[model samples]
Target: MALPDLARRAASRPRLPSLASQRRVSLCETLDRVLNKGAVVAGDIVISVAGVDLLYVGLNLVVTSVETMRNWKPAGTPVRQPEPLSQEIRP
Candidate 1:
């Protein structure tokens, strides 16, 4: 009974596509849709008249990704540039 159940379980398990195939499918389905389309947001800015006065009463914050977070660095910090190779020297 145990052997038959094990074989049945192995046979019934769904076959998964390879990682490369999965990546291709994901790119085709979601990434392509987002890249090749524009998203338009239509909504009301003010829910109520009372909310206008409450807007500035709380903290105002901006969120960004790690790659873009460096742009917010304070002034005076030296940004390091990569050294050029010897072959790129000008005459």
Candidate 2:
């Protein structure tokens, strides 16, 4: 078949229905998925002037859950403990 005929036939055909689910996800679930499975990007930026390197910047970004952030601790750093609530009555 000619290219124009083939194009016309294809255009005349009905489009297939979308495969996506009709249900809507809640805000909490969306937030959980985004924070827990988000991508981490680490890179650097370099600026050159007249063929000479002028400036360089390093960037490291992480998007994660609050629990993950709380559990993360730097090497050799002491872990902090939450202070107990005072039982004394205030006047």
Candidate 3:
């Protein structure tokens, strides 16, 4: 009884495209699409001591091609670069 139920569940699961049925994408094409559409890589890092988070670091990165940036803004909009995130610590 258990085995038959498990089989039925497996058969009902969604399946991905078969290898032959899917089109092959080159590295260049993949990179181009990602840059044009924009990709955000975000993560959080924690340095802890004895399960206590002593330091926490957040990271966010956006990677895009220069060509994509050229057309990123509206026709009448100005292009302004963002300020740097780092601050100089004067001791």
Best by TM-score: 2
The order by descending TM-score is 2, 3, 1
How displaced is residue 37 in candidate 3, in Å? Answer: 1.6
TM-score (C-alpha) between model 1 and the true structure: 0.16
- What digit string (tens of lDDT, one per residue) describes model 2 on residues 1-91? 3433432322232232352543333333333454445554434554323311111110011112322444776678754532221223569
Alpha-carbon runs more than 4 Å astray in model 3: 1-20, 39-91
Tell me the whole-model lDDT of each prediction, alpha carbons only: 0.33, 0.33, 0.35
In candidate 3, what are the lDDT values of residues 12-62, reduced to their tens digit? 322334536544333334334544445443445543234111111100111
- TM of each candidate vs. truth: 0.16, 0.23, 0.19
- Candidate 2, residue 69: Cα displacement in angstroms equals 26
What pairs collide in candidate 2? Answer: none
The TM-score measured for candidate 3 stands at 0.19
Give the C-alpha miss distance for residue 65 in model 1, angstroms.
Answer: 13
Worst 10 residues of 3 by lDDT: 52-61
Root mean square deviation (Cα) for candidate 2? 24.9
The model with the greater lDDT, 2 or 3, is 3
